[model samples]
Target: MQTAVGVFGGEGYKDGIEVPPLMVANAGQSDRPEISSLNCPPFVAVELCREHLGVHPCDRRRSINEYRSLFPAIDFSLIENDDDVLWKADTREKNEEVAARGLKFLSWLWTRKEKEIAIVTHSGFLYHTLSAFGSDCHPSVKDEICKHFANCELRSVVIIDRSMMGSDPATTNYPGKIPSGLDLPSDVADEKLPDEGKVN
Candidate 1:
C-alpha cells in the first residue's frame, strides 16, 4: 500500500507582467516548506509542465533545492534528478494524451516498491488524469478541480492495501480523487502562469 499525493503549481504571472528575475526565481520556493512535511521515503516526485512553457526538469530541481535550503530540518532524499520524472506535452490534448500520460505515470509508480510518493504537475494534467478513470466524467468535478488548481492545490489519493481510496468512483475527479483544500502556508503566494496560446 502506498500514498499518492498530487500538487499543482499556483497562479503564475501573466506574460509582460514584468515580474522581477528574483520573483521568477523565487516562484516555487514556498512549496518546498510544505512538501517537507510528508512522512514518506524513497519519494517519487513528478514535475509535470507543458512543453511549450519552456520549463524543464532542471528548473523543477532548482525549486526543490530552494525549499530544501530553507528547511533543512526535513529528513528525506529527493531521490536525485534521475528519480524525478518530467511529463511534457500539449495542454490541448489534456483530455487524451496528458491524462493518459498521468495515468501511465501513476501505474508505473504503483509497480515500484510501496512508498509515499509526490507528483507536482500542471492543473490540466491533474484535472484530466482523474477524469479518465471512468466511463463518464462530470462537469462539476471538473469545475471543483479547476478551482482548486486555480490556487496552489495539493490533493492526496491513498491506495489502501492494493485498493485505491479517495478517488471519485464516478470518474468525476482526475488523478483518482481530490482531497480537501490543501493545508498550505498562508505565505505561499499563487504563482501560476497565464493561459496564453494553447499547447499545439
Candidate 2:
C-alpha cells in the first residue's frame, strides 16, 4: 500500500522526522520493486515466496536480484528461511493454496512469540488471508478491510488471540498439519489503527 509505505519511511516522507528504518521482510515478489525503493534494509526470509514461485516470468528472478543488489552490505543468510508458505494466488485454487501457506507461515511467526513484525505482501494474498480467517467479522467491516490498502500503504493487523484458529475449514491450518506446538487462532479481528506508527 503506497500510503502505508509513505508513513513507514518510504518516499515522500515529511522532513524533520527521524523515523528508524524498518527491516523489510523479504516476502511476495509483487511488492519487491516498491520495497526496494523504500531505502531500507531487508531480511530475506526463507519462508518468503520466491519470484513466481520459481515458475513463469523470466524477469521475475531478474527483478528480485536487482532488489537484492540494493542491500549489498547485509548478510541475508543471517536470517534462516522456513519452509512454511510460498506461493502466488492466481486462481481460486491458487488462492486457497497460498492462503494455506500464509496461515502456516503466520502460525510459524506466532510460534516465535515475537512482539511485532511488518510484512509487505501482495493485496490478493492478503485478501485471501482475511477472507479465510476473518469470517467472524461483520460483512461491512470485512468489506472495509478489503476496500482499503493501496500499494505501499501500511496497515497493522493485530492478532488478538494467539490460541484459536478460524472456524472456517478452508482457512484453518491445525497444529497437526504443521510443526509441533504451533497453533494459530482460527477467528481473527483486525484492530484498525491510524497509518502513523514506528517503523518496523
Q: Largest lDDT belongs to which candidate? A: 2
Task: Tell me the number of clashing residue pairs for each predicted model.
Answer: 11, 18
Question: What digit string (tens of lDDT, one per residue) describes model 2 on residues 56-171?
Answer: 33313333344334433233452342221222334223556766766666666665545776766666556665566645445654565556357665677766442454332332
Cα-lDDT of candidate 2: 0.44
RMSD of 2: 12.5
lDDT of 1: 0.41
Q: CA lDDT of 68 in candidate 1?
A: 43
Q: After superposition, how far is residue 110 of candidate 2 from its true place, in Å?
A: 1.3
RMSD of each: 16.6, 12.5
Could you tell me the TM-score of candidate 2?
A: 0.47
Candidate 1: list runs displaced more than 4 Å: 1-40, 47-95, 136-148, 158-200
**Can you give the lDDT of residue 170 in candidate 2?**
33
lDDT of each: 0.41, 0.44
